[model samples]
Target: MSARQARIVHISIERNWREVYDFAAKPENMALWASGLGSGLEADGENWVAHGPLGSVRVKFAPENDFGVMDHIVTMASGLEVHNALRVVPNGDGAEVMFTLLRLPDVSEEQFEADFRWVLKDLNTLKKRLET
Candidate 1:
């Protein structure tokens, strides 16, 4: 079965795909763009810990790969885990960065919309940072 609701928020950058991936895929670099991780991530064993409004969450990121896969799993303090699928792919001479935003069960419509806007805003911030 498919997710009841989802959105693919993306942005195009005038840089090489590998370059975009190299920077965007870094956990440290995410704080500069990702709002939810704005407090930044701290190293915790094989995973990273992000302290947010809901409390500290364990984040496990996909190992560095050449295929531009930057997926990661976020385990909330309550033990609920959310898988975030992020990627950077080639597009003409530039790169297209995409983030799959899934609306978890019981999330209000307004909150889901807010999440979509947030992801797009983050992606735009990424594009601005990488382009300059």
Candidate 2:
């Protein structure tokens, strides 16, 4: 299976890139904007766990950095892993948040479109949470 489709969504937030990155990089603040994660993630030893429509999921994020990279790996209940490469970069006075969405080999076209929409929604949610 090789869907091999990729998409990137970016939103401009009225805040410093560092501030946006700091807030977005926190797992405890995920569910506040990321609807896919539902309510929130709870620390479970070295990994973070969350229960949502897809059931229990484990997530691991990249270590703290200065370049505003916020990549993360998500392990679904079904044992599937999704790698998300997210970034926050300065744009003049504010910042731009970007999320790269990948369509897995087994994902249908409809589901892929839905995922893009969800990513857009989540990015908007993040923008609102940080800009306000």
Name the runs in model 1 displaced over 4 angstroms: none
Model 2 regions lying over 4 Å from their true place: 1-3
Model 1 lDDT tens row, 9-123 = 9889999999999998888988898878858999989999888665788899999999999999999977899999999999888999999999998899999999999889999
Clash number for candidate 1 = 0
Residue pairs clashing in model 2 are none
TM-score of 1: 0.94
Task: Quote each prediction's TM-score.
Answer: 0.94, 0.94
Residue 129 alpha-carbon offset, candidate 2, angstroms: 1.5
Residue 95's C-alpha lDDT in candidate 1?
98
What does the lDDT come to for candidate 2? 0.91
